[model samples]
Target: MAGKEGKGAVKDSRINPFEDTVQRLRETFRTGRTRPAEFRAAQLRALGRFLQDNKQLLQEALAQDLKKSAFESDLSEIILCQNEVDLALRSLHSWMKDEPVARNLLTQLDSAFIRKEPFGLVLIIAPWNYPLNLTLVPLVGALAAGNCVMLKPSEISQGTEKVLTEVLPQYLDQSCFAVVQGGPKEAQQLLQHKFDYIFFTGSPRVGKIVMTAAAKHLTPVTLELGGKNPCYVDDNCDPQTVANRVAWFRYFNTGQTCVAPDYILCSPMMQEKLVPALQSTITRFYGEDPRSSPDLGRIISEKHFQRLRGLLSSGRVAIGGQSDESDRYIAPTVLVDVAETEPVMQEEIFGPILPIMNVRSLDEAVDFINRREKPLALYAFSRSQQVVNQVLDRTSSGSFGGNEGFMYMTLSSMPFGGVGLSGMGRYHGKFSFDTFSNHRGCLLSCSGLEKLNDIRYPPYSDWNKQLIRWVLGPKSCTLL
Candidate 1:
């Protein structure tokens, strides 16, 4: 079982293989088997067990696919996913209960609440960067919200894809969930079908295609796309402290992270000081020759390696700019004095390369950030709270980091998604459950309240109109 057929015992020819699977999932959803809180909790527990049982298998697959070390794999992918499963399991009962809402004067005697109902069948298309985390985290929400899910893992990450397709399905109820595998062609075929909901994580270009395909069936979608995230370094900060934080996140997973700081904004003087500090930090984290570092990950493929290697010429190399094509390795690199028109600055550099561009003041840094598409994550480093506040106040991003990196991801309380070009919608913990579930406004009234409702359905008269106005108007509160 290699390639797409690795999705359990299913086989893939030149034709569509998912037709039967999708229909079966929809049939399972119709049975209402997944709607119960106990069922959802049980599925979540099974997901947690899947993580615990296949920990070593997942780690090895990630290592094979991305050269991810055990520590990095655990921190970014496995642990976070496990925590999500645990959180959903702990909270599923409360999340499934109907929420009582405040009623107006006329409906005071009636029961009003929001019923969180599952969308029948869902499609989750995950990206390759954090394959397991991205795939399983969303799966937790879909399952917790009691929806049948069809998971499409990125085919580019072959090893992890294989593990997820073959091993993960054994944990969950096979009839209600599935792992569909393939490239763009397969995705296109999947998208052509009607689904209740679609959750996608990938590039903006492909996001547009997914959105377009979804428009045909009028299916709701959650597009977690990527953008060039900015990191602004204030002149008032300690160079070493800022460098260590920025470098650690910038090169994490060889900078394939969507939320990683893509570029640096600072004054010329600050840039000069920070460059040396960053050089020292990179050497410390990955060693003098990063190619020899077991902890450092390599680029995903030769195509991306060549693309990242091309960016090295965009600016003067202030730190590392080394590469080895045979090994698919690029050192944790930093480039300074980069022009705004350069390719590295223009695009999201999803590699270990970091570019630094000069801005005269905090105002300029804010202005520079605003001129571009809003990013998924934005960072402002300053010892002064006011400076950090000023940057936050002036700019918009999906998430903000003040004097830190992407540590906010660790907390399930915060949402993880983008705004504008970065992406749309959000997910994580309760938000994920909410995203998957439809909040239906519901009301139950007395069957014998016909006389009370007659005031709203009538031929016009001055007295009746006046009474209706009094009942529906803002002054109804005053009457109450």
Candidate 2:
């Protein structure tokens, strides 16, 4: 259950089947028919209709597997999908426009520009957590950039994957926008086939495998992986606001989110005050018996259920460690007296459980984080400008939120990704569009300028060198 079982004897499935699909899509890109605005618009419209028509099915499927509420599903999955389509609809014409740039020094006689071109066929391997949103978001980018996509949804979330496979092909073209359904075997097949680009979202362990596969073809990749996202609390911050923000974030998707606050590093003095506030805030959010609360969601599966349950046994539970397997519920739990070397502290908790580690001073807390791997997101609660600045300068995370939590990841305009072990690239809104598109440098020269080549035909002369320097040197004076 921890690692891939079959290594030597069994053929690696993550490479070969994924490759076959890409081979088919590559043929479509080779046809030269993908360059038209009409073709791009048609695909976007088809995708939009596909998502809208099957919105209810997707919402229900997510709820069945992950207990994701309808509002959460629609807001995170459907609205974002519609928004991407809207952006693509309004901007595809302009995004496809040829941009001209200023010519410099030696190239003054030539016109220079950059053309944003498609990366031919692309393969997007999405994660099970936030299955619909992760899958569709990348698909939007691929279509917006005018590239064919072969989407492979995680089999762990089988219900949602079945829904996507059943519904997506009804509206979109298989050759341009196809969904392949399978487990590790199918993913391996797809990765083996040469693709211009590969976008993968999952854990760092699997991300390494994807990167290794991509390296075989020298295909560029954008990996969105997880890290131990941390939270810091300064003494000056409002206890109520801090508690409310942390509770809401910890409960989101039962804390299965990649950007959720995994643990907190706070002052020893603020620990007692912060704990009560968080307990109160959690009660207010879900009331008593959070298992029965519709607003409060359940853990995604039994495996995750046992994993979080084991964390409770590792340390003293400070607040809320209730669980019911039949309900698939684990109350939002917080741990105190947690050792720095504890198993939960060593890796991303990725559950409703949160660990609070206390230090003597703010500097100590910052140093503790600095010593660990960089996280995907960092949150610090403080009203003091100096405290905020110090934390921001001291540690590195993919994104930052001060006195807030998890909201930054939702901002479509902001780029979302990790650094070091967290992730390799960012993709959202225009960033997403750029991730799937290749910007090519272009230069143009008039036929009449052919005589200018004489200056470079025999460039060994001192006179020519001086003449070239005169024309290419930086200007320091204003012309009359």
Candidate 3:
């Protein structure tokens, strides 16, 4: 009996490590050491150094995990994170300032403002695809907003995860930040703890679980989830250009990106032109054999590789449908005559596969998109601006890109997020800072203004009532 009790005690200790880390971070937050703007700036600078010093290490890890090229790693992960860090460092002061608001006659003499205060402790659960960018971008905002954070990076990306766990802590202040590593079990345990703010980036199925856990504590959440993003290419556009843009985004990161074009909707005539154009673009970009090209990335894991290999049978392969199991490589593939009811069409094809389905006209394409769950992004390629505007006016998505792909993500000024089933809440630049903060509505009145505030006191008369109404009424300038 004593032996069994001792074994149970040892088991409990193993599970308590994450709980202990969260408690420690909460204690650090109570100390108010992370609240100062200077401390936040120093942390941001350290993060920048972490990126700069370990650039090669990150590149190699990314390559090992996803076969990502040096250029792709820099552009998609390291550079994007570095840009976020730079933007936060430059704008931290302005973002941290209390915003002054207008007052009515009742409080014209008082100071009215919205104070952005940190939410104490924050939890960020990032996905495997674009792991560093997705994780660090939110981390920059949480830290800049002066919140102690706990980051849960995806365990699937083992190589990148190792670098983050092993090296990232050496750069930042350990007391105010921590990295907890594990699979779903660790995530489930972490969610049981109370965090002031929770930010998650993953699939909607897992997103629901995160929200359910957060609801237990009434914790605010920013869910950056994914969906089947649709791309509509009008017949009026140049087929080659449309194909280039679509192919680039669809196959970027081996199509593991949340915002990548999941499928294509176009007319029968346009589909014919697009197939050849896409074939040309794929060959041009990846050479005659994509598997031999050093630029193209391989699938992240054997499980995903097998899943993609199974999807090849869904439709008639028009461009590329080759796979190598040993290397976990799926050639840049495109399919036509794909039925809407097929498995490839029903789910997000997060692989190097693009399925083009025929739509009679723009109205049909719009109807098809509207009938499904709102996506993280919607794309339309057309030479006519009116056609683009028509699609934009008729649909709702987290973001709309006409004659482009996911290039809008490069601009930090725009808020990046999803709607409805895709996800909730916005982030990037100032949006991220705001998302991690509590906008406390505050007003300060003079201590000696009691006499002025007596208009509606116990001795309220008709004249005093009229005066109060007049003071509270809307201003003529406001009406104008």
Candidate 4:
């Protein structure tokens, strides 16, 4: 009875948690306490401890939201968040170091350096796919960059949201980091307010909305959106190795991963070999009936269950098409003979369903992928360097991987994000810290050079003009 009343009250009030977050952050920034590097380090360590102590809670939250197994949750979400914390903790001093730049010909008389300064406040809207890591990791970056952050965890994953709200405050300074929980309406309300930077990871449709909303404030945004991530099965790759990797990705969190291989693009002969291997691999991993298998995960909710059900109406099912509502499980489904017009082909199928499409040549697959929206990730499985280069040269995606699936996300050195339609900006490790910071270029000029600067004064002369040309123009080859 109270739940119904609470729903009505929420609808009537339409109160936005972000408003509170921004208000608190503004007050915190005014204190000038966060300017110290020591403060940032302390907070980061606290965050690290929080993740370590509450590993089980995090795991259970993911299970409640996505039916993710303990092992998969650790690999994909919890451990990654912890890794980001460790990375920031270890390298923060280097990131904050004042980087000097060698002066160009014109600026030789001046000293120039890039100072990485924190943006005052940042907002991160995380997706449900990897809810724990996506939200926490961005907040980690914001903290390391010495910016106040307001994290809006996806409400769809209520279990994760609950843990975050309960646990984050204990470890983090409430003013510097605020974890807000709500649905799309709450996110929409939050987007209305301006922030120095906004990091979002979700669907493309919502990415556009986030962009459009950010436009009102002229805020810079980092959008990490999904695409029809392609996984090419070339003949050269070790069939067993490729199959094992592919199967692992396809079934990880029941294929509810942003970087999960959405479609497999391969030759007819390769498909014949790949299909059987994939089938055997799936069986080996999850056993004969995924519906009853403890290793397999269930759909996040009824809405998604319906979405997957609709895709079946249009596409021809090749393997494993089973569902049990009581268990909230969908078997590892593989579809062949799927038309480009089908719904599965149209959108990012964020489920355990995998689609295999036969192509006449590599060029055909590349053209087909290019014709659609750019993906957040495109994976090409090939042993041949030439085939890898062909995929890289012909297609456009947010990020690419060779002979692997979803591994690009693991690299802290490399930036993680998407391109057009897939996403706008990049984040991860140092890249993320920089994303939350603004590199302010500072130039120092010598007072002794004031006489030399006077040569370009308002009193014009032929000699002055020639000197100006020589100074302003591109340098010549001869040494003085």
Candidate 5:
């Protein structure tokens, strides 16, 4: 019995690969190595170098995992990370500065400001669909905020995972950052341990699990979950223009994006027009044979391929439906005349499948969209501004695109995130830094103000009470 107990203890000690790693990172963070703006900028610069020096390797890994092209890799993943790093480096000084606040009558002479402090240790869990962008983008923010970050790259994308594990850590400070090396089991084990903050980008179902675990330790979490985003088309719009924009964004990244329009809401007549227009756009975007197109990427895994294949049977295949399981290649597809009760409409279709449903009128389209959870992104197409405004005013989403797609992500000034089930917090530029940092309210009062502090202490008469109330006016702060 003693030998058996000893053997069990040995296995349990080695169960979580991150136990030692997290401990070491926590120790390093306590040393104040990551607190200064200079050190933070240095790490951000090193991260930028990591992206530049290993651009080819990253592209190759992405190709191996998702069959992504060099152009797509550069445009979507590498460039985005680089831009984030550059922005962080340039803005680190100002971001680190203490922000002053308006003072009240009592504290007029005292210094008051909000200081942004690091949360110590952070955990970032990335999704497989965008292995690089999703992982590094959050890391950029965490590091800029002077937090020791542990990056958990998606295990499903093994090629990219290998690079992130073996290559990424070499570029940044080893003491402040780590790349977790394991699968789902290891991830679950790591979650058992507490973290200061957790930033997760994946499906909503998994997001709940992360939040539940974080709840035990009272750790704050940012869940970047995916949802069924809707794109509405009005009768007064150009079919070809809308089709081109929607098709490009939908099919971008093989339709694996979280913000991609999952389905279309339009009238029967508009659906009829969009069907042919979308067909032409798909053919033009990816030659006659999409399977042969280099711009097109394969599904990240066989499990995802099978799941997407199952959704293909939901509605009538209006445009492209051909798929090859052998290569994990799913052709850009369009489903028409889909019912709201269908499986495609029920969940986030994170594949190259776009389903179009018929609505009788604009009010009916709005009603259909409002029936489900709010989407991460909502798009409406119309030549008239009033028609677009109506949809915008009625619906609430994390973000909106008027006759466009997720192009808003390219700008560093614009913050990105979801609402409700789609996601919880915003991150992209300054928002990312703020998400990881704790804004500490601070006030450094004058050291010689002892006499003023004693306002009728232990002898609070009616006159003193009235004076206190009068001093704290409507516009003044109640903090006094």
Candidate 6:
């Protein structure tokens, strides 16, 4: 299910409960409590400990909320967050160091660099899908950057939300970290207060709402609003190999991932071949009855389950298309003969459903992908190196995968983010630290350089202007 940014209707006109929490954190931030690199490292280490200690509790919470399997939880959520934390810890000191900037002859004797400093009292609004990962991943970045943070985990994922609100804070310093829990109305109310920086993850429709709210406070935001990511299958590839990789990632976490291949773009002949291969792969991966498989997870909520159930009508059910509302389980489904105007085509199918839309050639597939809003991730499956290169060169996306899935997400060196409607800003690894920190350009000149700096003083003359111009000009640093 895609993350929801609820309308946040405040019916009773109740007071915002987050005022004290905000003020308290602001006070702590003002006191310079979170500024030291050592303090930041300690918080990050403690966060790692939180995950290691509560692995079982977290798994159980995920199971309660999404029926997420233990292995999937560890692979997708826990391990990924841990990797981010460890990476930040290992690189913290260097990341905090000021980066030296080249100097002109006018300021050649001055020390100039960009100091990365924290944006105090930030807010991280995480999504329900991959709750622990989404919530803590940014939390790790915020802490590493020395920012006191307030977390708003999706209320829909009550199990993980409970842990974040109750257990996670105990691991870190409460003065510098906090968790506030509520539904749409409460979140909207919380958004009313000003934050130094805001990080949001969810759908674009709600991204606008968050952006609008941030505008009032002039807060910088990193919005990870995911879209309907496309997966293009080349006619040159082996069907089974593509099917195994595609099916595994698409159905992983019951297709609740934002980066999962939302639909397939391929030729009619390829579609015909892929259907059977996908069917075989699905069976091999999850037993015939996917609902009984512990490896598979359930939809997050009744509303999302019904929405996905309705989307199954968009095309011919080429494979599994069963739904059990009682269990919030929708069978891993694939659709064929689907139209572009169908409901499934228009929206991000953040569920266990994949649709194949027929295209005549590679050119047509590229055009089809380009016509839509840029997605957070795009996948191309091909055996030929030229074909993968063509897709990468021609299309625009936040991230790309060739002959594979979202494995790029595992690499700390690579940035994970969206472009255009998918979302804004890059984060993950060093990018995360950079996103949370303010790069302040600084210069320190010697007090004894007053006589040497007199050429730039207000006493203007032809000789002084000529000297200042040449000293500050492009040729000053050039070789004679």
Q: Which stretches of candidate 2 lie over 4 Å from their true place?
A: 1-20, 474-480
TM-score of every candidate relative to the true structure:
0.97, 0.93, 0.96, 0.93, 0.96, 0.95
Q: Can you write out model 4's per-residue Cα lDDT over 1-480, one digit (the tens) per residue?
A: 001221211222455544555776877877876768999999999999988999998889888988778988898888888899999999999999889876555567677788988888888888877888888888888899998877777888888887876676777776576666678777788788888888998988899999999899899999888888888877787777888898888778888888899988888788778778888888888888777676888888889888887776656677788887777678888888877888888888988888888888888888888888888888888889899989988888888888878777888888988888888877899998899889998988876867777776878799988877776665731121
Judging by TM-score against the true structure, name the best candidate: 1
Ranking by lDDT: 1, 6, 3, 5, 2, 4
- Write one digit per residue (lDDT tens) for candidate 6, span 369-412: 99999999999999998999999999999999999999998998
- State the lDDT of candidate 1 residue by residue for 309-376, as single tens digits: 99999989988888999999998989988999999998999999999999999989998999999999
Stronger candidate by TM-score (2 vs 3) = 3
All candidates: CA RMSD in angstroms? 2.1, 4.9, 4.1, 3.8, 4.2, 4.2
Cα lDDT tens digits, model 3, 188-284, are: 9889999999999999999999999999999999999989999999999999999889999998998899999999999999998999999999999
- Residue pairs clashing in model 3 are none
Give the higher-lDDT candidate: 5 or 6.
6
Candidate 3 off by > 4 Å: 1-12, 476-480
Give me the overall lDDT of model 4: 0.81
For residue 412, model 5's alpha carbon misses the true position, in angstroms, by 1.4
lDDT of 5 at 87: 93
Query: What lDDT score is found at residue 310 in candidate 2?
Result: 83
Give candidate 1's error at residue 190 in angstroms: 1.0
Q: Write down the lDDT of every candidate, Cα atoms only.
A: 0.91, 0.82, 0.89, 0.81, 0.88, 0.90
